[model samples]
Target: MKDFLELLQRGARKRISLAELRQHYFSLYPDVQNSPDRSARLLETLRQLETIGALSLPAVGSWEKIGVPPLPQWVLLKREPKAVPRKDFGNVAWAPELGFWPELRPGQLETLLPINEFLLRRRGSLMVVPIKERSLEIYGDEKRLDGMCTGDSLFGGRLHLNTLGCFRVPQPLPYRMADAPGKPVLVVENHNSFWSFGEWNQQARCYSAIVYGSGDAFRLTGRALQQVLGQVAGSGAEYLGDLDPKGVRIPGEFNRSAEVGSPQVSPALVFYQWLLAHGVRRHRAECVSFDAASLERWLGAELAAQVAKVWQSEHWIPQESLGFEQLSAGVL
Candidate 1:
């Protein structure tokens, strides 16, 4: 999956040799799934990676056993404090911090990461191309943005590091009311749920909105949840996530480590009803599946039981499958 490859690239520091990856992934895979059936899946994933140019194959073993090319050299060397000449390194990229690489173009450079975005900003608009990666930076000088700080904007520009920046978004100021001053705050686990906060303004007025950009942000986002718990007077607050297991577990894990007296809520049935009403099929991708009823039944019977008993399970569901419309109705 794209998520898994991106995770590899991010943690491996741009590229990792093939041998290193086998050990890493093998360790993470469930022992029960380590047979030929799973190996087939692994090979399929590697082929997908090759098709996307995310993984390179150098006349060798399985495509999975290859090394990613050096991050195109220019990305590392361009970080020098001193300015360099804009010589036509012909066939070379013009990325500011990444310098020039034979394989890169102006459009592709920004997709590297936040640090690269900052570097490219310094490089000016002298024709640069990037690869097929997501970029969050506001490019070009003409279309200025508001309600955004440039320094913070650069931080937010990174697909990975934005975890920290989302934390800095405006927090609801502490308030003293006639009722219990603080109830438990709802921690939304992804950007879509966080964005949906606008539609639930009336409901949200009764609670604080804390955004954790991804399921991966559970630990970091837990800090914000802690802040709300400490500041609020009572523990009437509740947490909500998608109907899937991943959604169920994040808040459950956060509650275990961070808070007290709050309930973990799943709107699986609500989404199931909505899907039936609206006529949508569950889309399948990687670990995320849209079969709300099936997932709901599985979670209620197997996954929840496992969580309640074993305290460890890999069941995860992506909130995006329900679509924003259903999410706005609080069905995530």
Candidate 2:
């Protein structure tokens, strides 16, 4: 009977049927199925609750909670409620008309229950704001306000934030190189390679810029590659990474983009061939099979076949294995 009252109080629907109540009772006591008088006992409990003005029968089949208010002590207590905690909102205090508590920290609901209930009743909305702004708006405690915001942004040139205000900056992806030096861009995978390539570029004067592929080349550098290639008029791009499944796969994925026009991106075949010649060991255990068909579409038949052979052998060569000295010696 107590369980039935608790269910009615927590339920979103104001009314329930006798059949539903019977199901609820049976669910609570599955063993009661074997007893013949189980239905009679369940009906008696419902009648007892109705007699105590805890529930009411509006129609022949349906029942609803009466206008009985919760004990004042229940509201006054700061401890957890006796009934099961709500799933959506954790522990909560019950009131007559108001539903479950809003998402809040432990003692927060206890201290601010009246204010929260008032806001809900009068405004018909929860007072939602950032944690730092809550005190300033609710209690008029201006001293508690602290200016802080969170998220990521990208810039084409530069930006400066001096005041407490929201700012939206356009991403620098699909980045155009304005008045860039006349040379093809070299995309380097590792940080060491990126720096080494930069130094080599200064001496050899080959690339416009040495872009960093940052490990996951496709996901991290795809948009930037497209932007750089699209913007630079006569300049092409080449990718240099480890001669592994992932490294081989990166260049293939980049060429898959329809937006980036032809003379499509290709792997640095010369550098890879150098690594193989220098006795770069096969990491057969780590190597996984490659899709020859996909590679063939992006890379020519010869390069794709070579990559497939390496993949099948489970052989890999990290770009770092071909030290800066070796890489600098082999010019693109």
Candidate 3:
């Protein structure tokens, strides 16, 4: 590129026509003068010069040497030839229930052919093994399809392994068990709070379990409580969260949104009252609609009144305030 620019400066004028620029460039490299991609290759270098403020196309098919720039070492790369799209691949046949992705890039099926062929050779035999086991059998390496089954990750979401007859067990709901049947579990929102309750409850057997609510995750995973109740008949559940707008809303919203006959969720009223009394109130950068009626309806009028006053005072009591120390003290 430096040689090309220096050649133009020596033999060419301030303003050179495209033909003159090509003549100077070809004269410097006579080998590529007649190459099929000569014009494209030369244009790429010309674009580099134009980018560095050394040249400008003031008029069509004309070049203007704007200024001489201190040359930075520039590497000229030859563009790779575009791959020719395959006219077609041989007919692919998997089980009638399973098929190739609905959408294929110009030549994607050709790359994906071997996997389909392996499935076809199996004679429609479906899954008996776990997803990773099936993945190892098909691809000779496990985890090739891991985490690719969701939201366009697997072949653009055209197929899921489970839908393709490969069994993938869903992860079980995460929880800490107390093994105290027929007792209510306390589902704590924050991890520290869950740990405090989980460790204390293990010895005290105050709850059948101490479940980590995992914040918003509990809204969806609350059904796990049903699985808990199934094993511990006549058991119920209470929830403890930070004394914030979201905390107050979580239980009420979970109950309202859950399907009928879903497990009952109630506030751990005694703990919440204890939190009001002992938990330090801190100002937090939280965004929530301060709905007094919702608070009153969710917490009974008494506690709801205290929580509302806290909100009005612009402070909150996070569940973490009642840590292992407080629970271990057996004060509440």
**In order, how many clashes per candidate?**
17, 1, 0
Q: What is the C-alpha RMSD of each candidate to the true structure, in Å?
A: 17.1, 18.0, 14.9
Best candidate per TM-score, number? 3
Candidate that would win on lDDT? 3
lDDT per residue as tens, model 2, 1-332 = 45445655665554565556656666654434434445555656655666666655454323324312111111111122244332433444444333333433332343245434434444534334443344345435432222211221111111111111213222333222334466777777788877776766666666666667666634434445656665664277777888776776676665663233444565666666676667476677566666667767655687767767676777877787666686577633
TM-score of each: 0.32, 0.43, 0.50
- Per-residue lDDT over 1-332 for candidate 1, one digit per residue giving the tens place of the 0 to 100 score: 43345346556254455455555445444221323334444555566566655665444432433233211111111111222123343643334434333443322232233435455554443333221111234323211122222322322342322322232332332322223345445445566765554345334355533334356466334444445556655454444455444655455555554434433333334433343344323433333433334443435654444323222222333445555465556653
Clash-forming residue pairs, model 2: 174-227
Prediction 1 global C-alpha lDDT: 0.40
The clash tally of candidate 2 reads: 1
Candidate 3 off by > 4 Å: 1-83, 87-90, 98-100, 106-115, 118-124, 151-157, 165-176, 202-204, 212-239, 243-278, 286-314, 324-332
| Candidate 3 lDDT | 0.66
Scored against the true structure, residue 113 in model 2 reaches a CA lDDT of 51
